[model samples]
Target: MPRRSEAKSGAGSAVRFFVYRSPMKKPNTSPAKATGRCALEWIRPEIRALRAYHVPEGQDLVKLDAMENPYPWPEGLVEKWLDTLRESAINRYPEPSPEALKGLLRKTMRIPDGMGVLLGNGSDELIQLIAMSMQGSRRDKPRVILAPEPTFVMYRLIAMACGLEFVGAPLRAADFSLDGGTVLDAIEKHQPAVVFLAYPNNPTGNLFDTELLLAILAQAPGLVVIDEAYTPFAQTSRMEWLRDWPNLIILRTLSKLGFAGLRLGFAVGHPEWMEEMNKLRLPYNINTLTQASLSLALDHFSVFEEQITRIRQDREKLFRALSAREGVTAWPSRANFILFRPAGKSADAIHAGLREQGVLIKNLHGNHPLLENCLRVTVGTPEENQAFLEALGIVGVK
Candidate 1:
């Protein structure tokens, strides 16, 4: 496709130029329209086949689908935060390096000494940066990204978006723990450029075994990323592992810590790796508002930490409730969400029934073979949790 731009010469005469990029076939249709034949010619079939990541509409619903913190700031804290935002300079671009925020995050997250920080709009962006940094990034022989099946969807989505092949090493069928044998075998065969292990992985909500993870680090031939997005609930971290493994990087996000609106996530690792990934990060990628809000929020970290403690307690209670229910097989979780399966009911039917009763949660049927009949609900306020439990009982659960 050709992009038109105007430039000025030394004499100030206007100059027009057309830049043509490859991978796009010229279309017979004119540039006036962007659909129909034009889209067919320019869009990759791989992209066309992919479904855009969708967030289900939850207007007027109880809303527990996404793994997000359910509580808001206290009224007094809200006022103080508003003041911070009001004083922030939105007119100027944010610090591209975000040195102060990095220092604060290091203290808050307890990242090991000597590791550097690389910030992202969210962990999703950092994941993309890692994928883009792989050798032959823009498709010479398509680099490969490997991860255990039924983990976070972004690793696969970002890999394909960067013109790389994604390989899923199957997880243990009974539980969603890492299948060590299969993973090691796949790593040897694929020689993936990036291997992602989501600690307390998504959808299944179980932490992979530490011993198996270390084994993977030993066997993997390329970069190894530990995605600890749920560390706020799990209360364990692999930060110390970075001191030992040169190829290791740990990814975290404030989204799970009652600050999802800020859109801040970061990577902690050896300086050599962060220096390379930093090159692909867009200039001023994080806006001033986010930087200001996160700084203020971190100072009031105890407020969120208290909320996390309550959520952790409630998560156990909710787990017990699901486990005691006759038809539900609830898996224990170290994340804010619980994964369960219905014994004698259709997962879709149960999900739809809950929505009709003004409750919204994830329905994981058919997403992967291991996730069949599974649904995930985030731990909410006590009242909301009761609403979900009663709603589940009203649905097909015995």
Candidate 2:
């Protein structure tokens, strides 16, 4: 140990700062002796009980596991985009409130007038913010996040991460449609702080009835989030209904529309609610590059619109093909993917067989009891879908 020395600018005519000029000792780099410290012991048990979200490797495969736009940017779009990025202020922080980009989104997504939009790094971050905003808001009871079972997993995962109670009401076993009575009952019981319903629901690929959703919205005691991540393919929205439901907000993302890399997701709702969410949002959460790139892409929004149109057509064709197959039963979908079950094979066997044939898709056999023996495939380019259909036949799923 050594005492500090004084350092002054220009030989001590100024107020000086105290500085330590003592000889420095080499720090110990040896391995620590065990003191019985365990990170799991310190971490929240809810978190400890959860598994990290896993994305299966689809490298060098016709990746249809995740519903992504199968086409790359049209010719010359990439060059035009690079020129725009070159002009962005990379050294400066992005807008704390990105008004121009929000304007572009409002126009592009047809966001209703007078509604406020809050952007997030992605849909997951937006969900986290929604959960955090309601966390600990109730003093007498545990705050809850609710959704239908066999829908999106993030609603529950995010709820757990935020220390809120998660409740999932089951969908009907016959088709993945929401049982309004069951959901209404769950909402009445849980009185969730937020209820997340994925329009054109995930994995199962069927949209819940509109009346059922409105009924749930009417019964819900707190905020309702309609996640329209697949709206481009679904071609329907609840955004217009925002004028009617004060407790409602809708979530949309550019991921399925071919900007997944940019990681932008926005929520449109009343200013009162948006103001509270904006408080928890990290400054510059949407980076300069993302904001610029998405704004420019919206200018060429027609390119995605065309691709979406083609994908919608391909979805029906794929659905018909799966339906025509002798051993498979495919559910109808408003989204760009189809969920089907194979009569003579297990989902694991079929999924692996597709992978071996250089194709990839989701296998949801054990994710829930209702999803048993079920598999989901995204509508891809003609060649990719053909490859998958062929793979399915080869694997005896036909």
Candidate 3:
């Protein structure tokens, strides 16, 4: 490239133009041109080996796959919520402790006085936070995270992501209940730093034997988390047990309680553990909008209570309908969903058939050996539940 000469306005003038030639070839900065192993190499080997969690698309379907409340807020309640949101100061960050919201949750969830509550973007983030907290400065030995097998996938996934070992004890094959002996044995062997118990567990949707859980809690080496995400339908919670078991922490989410879109979850436990977790939490983790919306919703908590009551009723009705169907065995559920197996038909095909018929339910066929041929459907509104049943019938599941 040619350089342009600077024009001299006076006797002496400074040069005003400069030029440089382009490189003969562009530097090979593109990942494809460099070694095959690139930016991913910087990621922890555990994370690199992991597969991203998958959420199937559910557009224009009955949408019963995820265990979300099927009913939307009543129109009047929604207007009130919008009005509350209008007052939220998005320009300012939310309170670090979110004392007002936490107080409401503490009272609503019946968290014992003197207990501490730490909020998260959702229960998913709380799980990750717990995993991170378990990973102390001692990176020499891998910490173990234990949970009953086929319970919740995040317990294992988050553990691995945090470079901790995840140990899953298999539940009794007969009824998807915890095998206390096996779990205790595994606890002794693994000496895990954390144990996750999904109360009224997912996929299977049955509450584990309370005695077995108490046994596990007694023997656990470190913290024990009782995830009560579905407690609204189950009508049970362990939040009040914090005084009895210092090692116990209760995880609850407003997600299943019909605030899923707001993505608010709270972890209630002794302050010792809560303080440690707060250290690792990023500032403003829960945004101002979420805080304001949650405050308004908590004010009208009765609305969600009504919805949950209806879901519990629908759960029983759906269970009965499933049990009455031929070639189908539906498990009893305390949560807002049912797990059932279809005889003389492929669960995968049945799931697809349901999809084809414009209904969506979870197919747990290959997720775990215990979950083989099992499908879970969230209890929806009466019409939606009826539509799902009709689709299930069309799939030859009857």
Instruction: Give the whole-model CA lDDT for all candidates, comma-separated.
Output: 0.91, 0.90, 0.88
Error of 3 at 279 (Å): 0.5
Clashing pairs in 2: none
lDDT of 3 at 246: 96
Model 2 over residues 124-203: C-alpha lDDT tens digits? 89999999999984667679999998998899999989889989899999988899889998888888889999997998
TM-score of each: 0.91, 0.90, 0.91
Cα lDDT tens digits, model 3, 1-398, are 76666665576867577676665875678768455555456667778788898899999999998899888888998898889888888877788778998888877777899998999999999999999988853347788999998887889999998888888999888788888889999999988999999998987888888888889889998999999988888888777778999999999899988878889998989999999999989899999888988888888899889989999999899999999999888899999899998899999999999999999999989889988899999999999999999988888966
C-alpha root-mean-square deviation, each candidate? 8.3, 6.5, 5.5
Q: Better model by lDDT, 1 or 2?
A: 1
Off by over 4 Å in 3: 1-27, 34-36, 136-140
Which window of 10 residues has the lowest lDDT sum in candidate 1?
Answer: 135-144
